[model samples]
Target: MTTRYIDAGVNLTSSQFDDARDDIVMRAKQAGVDNMLLIGTNTQDSMHCLQLARHYGFVCTSGIHPHDAKSTQADYIAQLKTLFLHPEVVAVGECGLDFNRNFSPRSEQISVLSQQLELAEQNNLPVYLHERDAFDAMRAQLEQVKVHGVLHCFTGDKHALDFYLHYGLMIGITGWVCDERRGAQLQQLVPLIPDDRLLIETDAPYLLPRTLKPKPKSRRNEPAFVEAIVREVARLRGQSCEHVAKISHANFQRLFITRRGTQ
Candidate 1:
């Protein structure tokens, strides 16, 4: 039987997909990726993501990303709150710290992330977090609030992985795990994540798995290619692709769908 999969995160709103969104979704469906979670990096983008989710019958997130944190409007949280009222808007982020790039002032990133965490807590919605080279700060902020969500595109070390798992957030593994050099550390750490806490994502149009055979000419990753990430994850974890696909799908359901008390 074919192994079915759910792409835990996808950036369908990226301008690269402007002329090919329909084809992209269809190709993913054909590849056995039946569902996806569209990511929104800001309020306007979140609205666009919601529209795409509605159009495609997929779920999405709504929040400002750390890079864009400094530019957030005064009513950003209120805007996110309104977006959450829609069942399609299942999580409250793409928000977190990125000390690696320092695209936004660290202080502003922390402030914005704190407010979004509070918003997630208030609505009882899970978050779709992002962190990079700021694990200590992220951990400190997380301790101050009660929230649950996936640490999307995780690339931290064992200490960071251990803390997130213990804190009860899901671990989202992306195609970064497919890179032999940069992913070497992550490859070693993949098997450490417990089954229930694992999730697979493409983070499409970004981290395309280097393991893909006959690599696409455009080098553009999409939901369909998530299978490559899953296969790599399964291989590292000593499990079948089917097992990883099943548990990740279940994890996604629990974290996003089931928690909403909807079908």
Candidate 2:
């Protein structure tokens, strides 16, 4: 039997899909990607993602990204509260820290992340976290709050992976795992994630899998390519693609759906 997939993260609101959104989603479905979680990086984008989710019967997340942390207004949490009322908004982020670029000041990123964590705890929503070269600070903030979510597109070291797992986060793997060079560490670490705590994503329009054969003419990633990540993860873990798919799908459903079954 063929394994079906659920994309844990997709930036379907990206301008790259401007005239091709419908086709992109259709292709994803044809490729066995039956569901996806649209990611919203800011309030306006979150609204756009929510609209798309409603239109397509997909789930979505709403929050300020670390890159946009400085732009977080005092009323940002209020804005998120409104977004959360919609049934399609399943998580509280795309929010976390990125010291690599530090587009936003470190202080601002922490402040915005803390507020989002508060929103998650208050509303009983899981978070969709992001961290880039800022794990120390991110871990500090996480320790202060009780929030649960996937660490989306994780490409960190074993230490970071263990920390998140110990903290009870489901790990999200992407095409980065398919990169022979940059993904070397991830390849070695794939088996470390237990079956029940692993999730898969494309982070579409980005992180195109380097292992994709007969690659598309354009470099833009999409939900359909998520299968490649699943395949690689399965290969590294010495499991069947079917097993990985089922486990990841179950993990996704449990984290984003079952936990909120009461809502």
Candidate 3:
């Protein structure tokens, strides 16, 4: 049987996709990735993601990303709530703290993240999180709420991984695992994530797997490349690619689709 996959996160709304969106989705399906969670960083992007999800029969997220936290309007929560009314919007993020760039003030990031967490809890929806150099703040915020979701594109160390796992969030690994040097740590940590909590994403238009041969000249990542990520993850965990693909597909369903009574 052919192995199938679900790319747990994808920025399908990115301008980088431009006119090739249809081809991109087709290529992903041809490569065995049948479903994807389109990430939304703000109200406008969230709506675009939802439209794409509806058109392509995929799920998506609805929340503001930390980088945009500073510009979040006074009624941003209201906007998110409106987006959540659509079942295609499964999780509450692409949202979290990013002290690494600090494009938004630390205070704004915290406040916006806290509000989104509350929205997730109130709606009983899982959160699709992003964190970079802000694990401590992320952990502190998570402690105050009962939210569950994937920490998309996780690159943190064992301590962060342990806390997220214990807190009941799924782990999302990306093409970063395919890099020999920068990915060294992630490769070592891949085996530690439990099967039930493991998810894989492309974070497309970014993080192209360095291991891909005949690399695309544009260097733009896409959902189809999730196959490479799965294979690498399988190798790291000493398991078959089919097993990793199956479990990640199942995990995505459980966290986003199944719980929402959609597939």
The number of the candidate with the highest lDDT is 1
lDDT of 1: 0.95
The sequence of per-residue lDDT tens digits that candidate 3 reaches over residues 99-153 is 9999999999999999999999988999999999999999999999999899999
lDDT of each: 0.95, 0.93, 0.94
lDDT of 2 at 166: 97
Q: Is candidate 2 or candidate 3 better by lDDT?
A: 3
Using lDDT as the measure, name the better of candidate 1 and candidate 2: 1
Per-residue alpha-carbon lDDT of model 1 for 1-263, expressed as tens digits?
Answer: 87889999999999989989999999999999888999999999999999999999999999999999989999988898899889999999899999999999999999999999998888888999999999999999999998999999999999999999999999999999999999999999999999999999999989999999979998999999999999999999999999999999999989999998752
What is the per-residue lDDT of model 2 for residues 50-139, given as tens digits with 9 covering 90 to 100?
A: 999999999999999999998877888899999998888999999999999999999999999999999898888999999999999989
- Shift of residue 256 alpha carbon in model 2, Å: 0.5
